[model samples]
Target: MADGEEVTLDGRPLHLLRVADLKAALESRGLAKSGQKSALVKRLRGALMLENLQKHSTPHATFQPNSQIGEEMSQNSFIKQYLEKQQELLQQRLEREAREAAELEGAFGAKSGDFGNLSHLEGIWVKFRRIWVI
Candidate 1:
């Protein structure tokens, strides 16, 4: 497998493991090992996905609180921070897109009235017609 490729729970690269290796890996995880090769691959992928979700979903020890109110407050703060960061990123992206659109319009001569004038359009049509005639 490639270096950037994802691995299984046992650190073995996915899509490169043989049938026996798959069975062994499933057995090690106490998962069902009885299935066809495709089924085995699907089961292993599902296990890997579930493991990743569980790892990411678990809160850090520092975030854990003894009191329920304290935990709720901490969670609320985290959520607010996350939302603000997302909104800032979105605003930056929108501004970048608007700048790019303006640049494209300038490059295509749209700001110089090249597209707004009928004479320029007729010149473009004449050039296009000449190209087809040749």
Candidate 2:
């Protein structure tokens, strides 16, 4: 965001792209303990995420309408992109579950009505995700 400030490409912000650049940056500053260094990296990553999130707005589905007070913006390219990315993520999750279920078929041989405890039926899914989410 500022001169000499680092930006993240992956989950980590402090990853070294070029060894020379990393060496230069480190040599430019004093050192800390390895644990402290990792914590600093995490904090920097969190700050960058918040900064990036502020730039891109997403419309959230709400129980009580807030459009009256207008804190949430109307759906835009950002919201559309978020929905598309979410759909892709969900599709990948479904495919993973299908694969896992198929693998379990030989062992469990379960039918539609097989599971008694809803937890067993739900398998890998969390509680709120299974509740009226359909």
Q: Write the per-residue lDDT of candidate 1 for residues 9-38, one digit (tens) a residue.
A: 467665678999889878987899998988
Weakest ten-residue segment in model 2 by summed lDDT: 66-75
Measured by TM-score, the strongest candidate is: 1
Candidate 2 lDDT over residue span 1-134, tens digit each: 55477676453357643444333444444433243455555544555556577788575657566544322322355655665566557657766766666667657887634434433535534442443132
Q: After superposition, which runs of candidate 1 have C-alpha atoms over 4 Å from their true positions?
A: 1-12, 60-134
RMSD of 2: 15.7
TM-score of each: 0.36, 0.30
Q: What are the lDDT figures for the candidates, one per model?
A: 0.67, 0.51
Show pairs that collide, candidate 1. Answer: none
Looking at candidate 2, what is the lDDT of residue 102?
63
Task: Write down the TM-score for model 2.
Answer: 0.30
